[model samples]
Target: MEVGGSPTWSEPNGPPSPDLTSHAELPEKLRPKNIFEIPVWMGEPDRFCGLVVEWNNEPVHVLPFQKGYMIFGRDPAVSNTFVGHPSVSRQHAAIVWSREDRLAYLIDLESENGTYIDDIQIPLNEPVKLLPGHRISFASCFRRYVFIDQYDRVVKELRKSRPTVRVRHILVKHAESGRPSSWRGETITRTRDEARAQIQSYRRQILEKQEDFGRIASEVSDCTSAKRGGDLGPIFPGQNKAAFEEIAFRLNVGEVSEPVETLSGFHIILREG
Candidate 1:
């Protein structure tokens, strides 16, 4: 069975050895049978974020997130979140939470099996920003930890009245857009005409060829949301440019929009909801 990160209560040393003299003074029933019976000490965590672990649709463990960071690994001596698996390293990865930015980042510590976020293996040591409901996996372990943001009250508030729309898009950037740098940090040199043609071709594939929009967006979209199959989840009004939202709001669910030009680039939007 897969094991999730449980707090490392103490050093990796096995349960403390009982003194012979103390054992002699104790009653027979009180005498220790084995080290396995010894209890591991647990204390209240201080200044931890409200990170909850759920099992079978019920909250099972409540892990407090510290301000700086927390480690995940096999060796309890070095890791804050301990996964007792052979494939996991002693110091596997870390989750660094930033209070000011209200964001958490996952950093792989040059592990043997690597760390993954939503099935995507992250680069070693380079911090990848995490969003709420993102699934994290260490090594080849089957257990996945879902990153929960306790500070999503604003999103909950917005959902009350102003409903949001989910969308997937593919962007074809050109040098004429003035900002040709893609989300992947690559420079786009295509002209406006070239970009327009590329976007139209993608639309045709989705409309006529019945190709998967998400797969196409993940393969070619210039936006960071490409990592999430070009999903820009729950876009609220004013969160995106006027030109982009104009076509986005007008389309019915499951409808694909024609090439829409924005300041960033030419885009083909797929209304998901």
Candidate 2:
């Protein structure tokens, strides 16, 4: 007999099992919000301008924000056109336009080590947006001065013209011993150190395998509930690790992330909704 109208399989006597794979077919709901136009100082306002790594004036690497922030490389010859560096932090810098606040901020992601704002380091993971007159430091073999001009007039104009959007998300985790942890209200961390620390802690837990992240979860989880098998439900944007949140929000729903390490433990995230 045909199964579900397909001739290749036998029909079930009762209702057929729900298709688990259907979850995979669901469309992702999250969307990328429009930020703003790239500032003139970062690139050619006409074209996407930034510090780009080039070989003999031919573009090889494009620094996200290179105009406002300066970089020093070991070789001055190759470094002038393209911010030369051994790593992302040592070679990228920019003055960014913030979509949320409609403000122009400077970020120097290109440095031998990295740069910081208000004492918080930039670009170990993500880029920092600079504020007007904010101090920026650059490190190569030695320290150097970086400048961010006061452009409040432009910022004020942008803020008056652009509209802002409010995005919300939920984070889900398996409960322990049938008791799930209460949802912590949303938090927005302003400092880079605070964000980095949170991401680092989450990574440590995952590396240790203390939380039942499924698969190996049965073997190492401290939570009794997941002993039934770690099955965390739906997770929304901004719910977990900052690093994870940074990337996760970019993904469509029903996509499973490669194992992500967090302070709680390793996680195999499956976005439900």
Candidate 3:
């Protein structure tokens, strides 16, 4: 249910009248039918990456596996993914990430239609480990999910092969006339360690908050591709430099690289494709 960003909850759907202070005090007629709550993404590293909801062959909804309970249901105000179907409850089910065990469990939120794993109904409120290709369903609502983690093994299962990824980069030169990574009209006139520190900060923000890589690349990237959000297009193995290929083949689709050193400069990579 949680998505990482600027630590702000998304209220995509709000109450009919913004003046209503008390949800309980609001009159029935003025009540908003769909109030969705964007789950607060946890900053914990090494947690499960996310779940791809592919129910009924519908468009996928990515539910990031962040540090807290991921709540799902029809109530947009409370649930991260609000199922528009009639069968879905406002607060139907939740997926909890156990830090100690490094496992994710699907617990029924006392949903009316019940929650299912692989077509079998699970006991209420009990935790169940969702395996790869395991379908997490809410009753007969037709919503389904396939889970994937940050590790390359899990990513291979998700894509059915090692992918040829597209990547974008913001390169900051460290030598003479070194320039800033972004479009701030600044130059990298600092020491190598200082440049790395600055670039690494950008990488940290993207990973911790799930910031949009393309947007950051657009604003700060030093390369000409910054105009296109540093898009390098589809890159196969060995097509890029040794270090770049090392990261490209190993990184997950949405992963960001720490500031990397090359002959030319330090670069921050985003696996766009």
Best by lDDT: 1
lDDT of each: 0.68, 0.36, 0.61
Candidate order by decreasing lDDT? 1, 3, 2
Q: Write the per-residue lDDT of candidate 2 for residues 1-273, one digit (tens) a residue.
A: 111121111111222233311223545543211122233223222123233332433444333432332333222211221222334231234344433232334444334466655445666323355443344443431222233333455445645664322222222233211112322332232333443454345434554665323444454333343444444443333223344455455545645455443332334443434
* Model 2: worst 10 consecutive residues (lDDT sum): 1-10
Ranking by TM-score: 1, 3, 2
Per-residue lDDT tens digits for candidate 3, residues 1-273, read 333212222223332232322344667776544322322221242545677777457645576766566676655455565555557676677776544334456778777798988889987755576665677778666657776665445444645544578788877665332123335565456777866887888788887886677887787666777798879888664344456667666777777787777534678887766
Each candidate structure's TM-score, on Cα atoms with residue i matched to residue i, is: 0.42, 0.27, 0.41
Best by TM-score: 1
Clashes, model 3 = 10
Mind sharing the TM-score for model 3? Answer: 0.41
* Runs with alpha carbons beyond 4 Å of true place in candidate 1: 1-161
lDDT: the better of candidates 1 and 2: 1
Expressed as tens digits, the lDDT of each residue in 27-100 for candidate 1 is 77875332111011112222335445544445556566653566777654345566655687767887765332
Candidate 1, which ten residues in sequence have the lowest lDDT sum?
34-43
